[model samples]
Target chain A: MLWACLRFPQLAFDALRGTLPNTPGAFAVVAGPAQRRGIVFANAAARGAGVRAGQAIATAQALCPHLCLLARDPAAEQQALGAFATLAWRYSSDIHLREPDAVLLEVGASLKLFDGWPALERRLRDEIARSGFACRIAAAPTACAAQVLTFAHDGIALTTTAVLQGALAQLPLAQGGLESATVTALHGMGLRTLGDLFRLPRAELARRTGPAALLHLDRLRGHLAEACPRWQPPARFARRLEFESAAHSTTALAFPLQRLLRELELFLLARDGGVQHFVLVLGHERGASTRVAVGLLAPQRDAAHLLELARVRLERIALPAPVYSLALQVDELPPLTPPHRDLFDTRAQGGLDWPALAERLRARLGDGALHGLACVADHRPTHAWRHTPLDPAAPATRDATAPAPTANRPFWLLPQPLVLRTAPQRILAGPERIESGWWDAHDQRRDYYVVELRGGQRAWAFTEAGSRQHWTLHGWFA
Target chain B: MFTSTADLFALDSLPASTAWPVAAPATTPASAPASVPAARNTAALDTVLRHPGIWRRRAPGTSALATQPSGHAALDALLPGGGWPRGALCELLVEHDGLGECSLLLPTLAALTQARRRVVLVAPPYVPYAPALAAAGVDLRHVVQIDAAHTDTHWTAEQCLRSGCCGAVLDWLPRSDYRELRRLQLAAESSGTLGFVFRPLAAADQASPCALRLRITTAMNGTQFELLKCRGRLGGATSLRLRA
Candidate 1:
């Protein structure tokens, strides 16, 4: 099986840098127990000023007086690595996450789908870089070999087992992924490179360094099987971002919100689905968390569009307190159906579609502000029509089976019939009786007539049965 | 060079410039024919007439404006383009409600909805009776109603008109100024959608930026329409015998 491994050499620095709004200044990640704290990774600005990794924090500060030191966060690093794996999940399903630094994917089946290795490699590199991560990639015949090759060199591709074996032999014993104690013991035996150890007899090597070292060598050489648990994306997406400091205004939260949205986008891509509804919980410094729920008419995964919708919704909310952290949770992700496009679609390019426009209007207005009209196929004028949710996919045609009204109907109907105190100037037409809803409790027996008001406005006036004096203005012919 | 002042007025002595029609021929080279300059002038005039802002009357039975028929023969004859102008805002100033105001637009709205184009009603005063609309041949599924506040009525209509997905946006604005009408007009023009705004008759005297404005009142036999402002024609009035 062909395997591709991506190693993040500066994962600690990269993970922390993504959280900050800007990283133009000199920065370094210092980790280790309190007394031996040293620079694990230094950014370009610090490196330009002679700051190097593994140097004590004091020495690094001396080299660059203004170095901004951040303690290494292992949780954030693992989260960053999982995000990268989620991105690579689009390329292959058989993915294994190596602790601390690397991830391996069996890309044998994906090579054909991606038009071979070089194309896939270029795509992986471009996407990873766009996601704000620096990675060293290598490929070999086995997963373990591929992981080991990443330390030796970046962009190494060994297709066959013989070639992989030959390449692995040239690497120093330190890059063999062995424990430091075992490597020290092997070094004491005059073994400079992996090829020197390979020349020794198997029984003798196992007697000297124990069976674990032999198993490691055998796994790297494709002799023993390496079983790593496959990483599965969670059923639901829930990502949280803790602010370096409490954000007072909503504007201060836009950057972290955007980063979380980007991660949500990658997560949706991995699942090959779209989100119709998601909630953004703003963790405040005091009181309960504020929840901003964004609902769309259709499933959507575009980050920019989602961001715009979220921003519009956020503007209407009043922050109860300064937000200390933010969380994005999407419980239900429906399958996305790509819109159908004709060869010559007359729609304006880059203009919002119907669903997007409706969402934008509803984002500003309340949810119940917009509705569609549907004929209810009833005899009562009030019960003849109902408001429905606007669905663009439904055909814009009425049911042909419903019987048409014989009498003339007014264009506008009042929500409640208004009582007309005075009589009309003239009657245009006689009463067309309507006695409907007998089976239901709303029994009505009314005689409707077309009447002309004093100022020459037409009205739909109706009177109860056996009473012609009590005329009620039910509708307007506007 | 030492000639009298009268020599400057002479046709032959006048400097050869396009501004002076008589001097243009003298500036022409001997190799070119006389028809070239005349053709160039006609081409320049054609360019000016091609602009949308420039209104020019065309020959009878050869109209150049894009319009949707109002479905009434007499009313269509009174309009400049033989019907309602497309891609522009039209204002209907009603003397009062139920003066055949909704009937005036039922035909055009029906035609648009039948073609599967969306028609949005923003802040309508009353419920648009579905039975009447269905009998009028309007597709019910294509009709969307938006209930917005007084402040957001114009904004919602402008957005629908500019969305390009809508074929018509009908709005009822109880109160609005010239700036709001101007914004709606621009949005309709950009998206090439029909926009109809209904205002009270009192606003008829106020200057509006809509492409067309009509004042509807009741006549002896039927409804009367006075064309207060049409983009390319003089004001005229017509009466139609429409059913209530």
Candidate 2:
């Protein structure tokens, strides 16, 4: 198996840069704000001024008077790592996150699909660059050796067992991620390079150190395989962002909501799916949560479209209280079907873009504002049809056995039949009787006829045949 | 050269400069032809034949404009360019709400809906009888109804038309101003949707910006259609009949 390891040496600094647009000066990411705070990461400019990692905050400030310090945000670092893992997953399914800064990918199975090692490496480099991360990539026969080489070199691919062993032999024994005491002992014993340590007898190394050192060496050299749990995408997308200050208005929430949506878009794109239903929960300071559910007629993954829909829905809502946190959850993710386009036709036709327009209208006008017409198989004119919510899954078509309309059905049917006081001047057509509806409530028995009024207007009027001889105007004919 | 007032004003003594019409650029070599004609017979016959407004001799009722048949031959013949004018408003004025107005437009709506294009009905007087629409061959899935109040009726209709997703939008406006109608017309023209507005017959006396306006009234045998305005024909001259 071949493994590629990508190490982010300046994860703390890069995380800040990825989140904010314009960050000035050479700042160090400190571990904490209290008594235990120390510089965990420093940029090149800060290093030039004598500030380095593992230095006390006071000592760093004394060395570089203008050094800006920022507290390390573990949440942001974890989010950034998740985003990178999603990017790696596009090329290979077997990927593991090496914490604080690296992603390990088992790419042996994906080499053929990406046209072998050279092309795959090139693609990985280009995609990482596009994602705005500075990574040092190295490949080896095992994940452990690849991770170690990524820290010291750039783009080193050791494919076969001989090449891996040769590359590992050239590395200094200090770079094997051993404790400082062990490295010092090795140095005192005059073992500098990994080759020197390997040349020693196995019994002698165990006598010098313990069996843990030997096991670590074996795992690094591919002699022993360790279980590297593969990262799986979460079944549903649920990301929460805590605001520094409570957001009092919807406009204030847009920025953070946009970041969450961008992440969701990347997540969906990696899985080749689209979201149909999602909910936005606003957490209030008083422990109450306001949830806004946004549903689309079609599955959509476009960030701008989803944001626009969210904005419209948010406008109509009255916030219960100031929100301290916001969470986005999506439960329904349907596979996206690419729209079919006619090769010969070049016009921007109305096949795919209409759903976006419908979604936009729905967002503004509110839910239940848009619906399609459906015909029920009832004999009563008022009970004949109903309004159905529009669905994108079902294409527009009529069932073959859908009841064929009679020739004389009126276009307009009154909700309640208007009682006719006077009789008609001329009888134009039928005394057709529609006497159904004994099964359900509101039974009706009447003799319906088409008669013309004195103004030469034809009307569909029905007369009760039971107790009362009352005439009612049911509808109008063309 | 003589230095005198006469030398400056004398036509014969002064050197002639190149005139504006015949002046040639120094960079452009004299080898190239001069004075290319501004006007040329660049109109191709194929494009002319494809133009929607132009009439062709091959067919009697065919024009270049794409048309959805009205499902009534008599009404189709009465309309200019053979069928309903696309991307323009067709105003149908009636005395009352339910005087066969919906029936007149149902055929066209069904045809558009059947073709998988959306047909939105905005602010109808009553619920659309779905059984009747389905029976008329309309794809029920594509027929959307927007419930808008009187204040938001025009705005909703304009938005639906401007979306370009709907093949047709039918709006029943109880009262509308001339400006609103013009805006609706412009939206329809820009989005390429077939627009139909049902207005009161009293508004028919006022001039409209619609492409086609017909006064529909109940006649002896059936519904009568009087063409009030057409794109390329004289208005109020033709009357067509449809069976009841």
RMSD per prediction, one decimal? 7.6, 10.5
Q: Provide the overall lDDT of each model, using Cα atoms, as 2-decimal numbers.
A: 0.84, 0.79
lDDT of 1 at B93: 97
Off by over 4 Å in 2: A12-39, A42-71, A112-134, A201-204, A238-260, A280-292, A314-329, A344-352, A395-404, A424-439, A465-468, B1-66, B113-117, B220-222, B234-237, B241-244
Model 2: per-residue Cα lDDT at residue A259: 88
lDDT minimum window of 10 residues, candidate 2 chain A: A345-354
Tens digit of per-residue lDDT, candidate 1, span A92-186 = 99999998899899999999999999999999999988877889999998998899999889998999999988888899999988888999998
lDDT of 2 by residue, B36-109 (tens): 43112122334433454333345445555666678777788877667888888889998765467777778888
* DockQ of candidate 2 against the true complex: 0.31
User: A22-104, model 2: which lDDT tens digit per residue?
Assistant: 75677889996588799999988899999989999989999999998888888888878887888889888999998979999
Please report how far candidate 1 places residue B80 from its true position, in Å. 1.4
Look at candidate 2 and tell me the lDDT of residue A1.
91
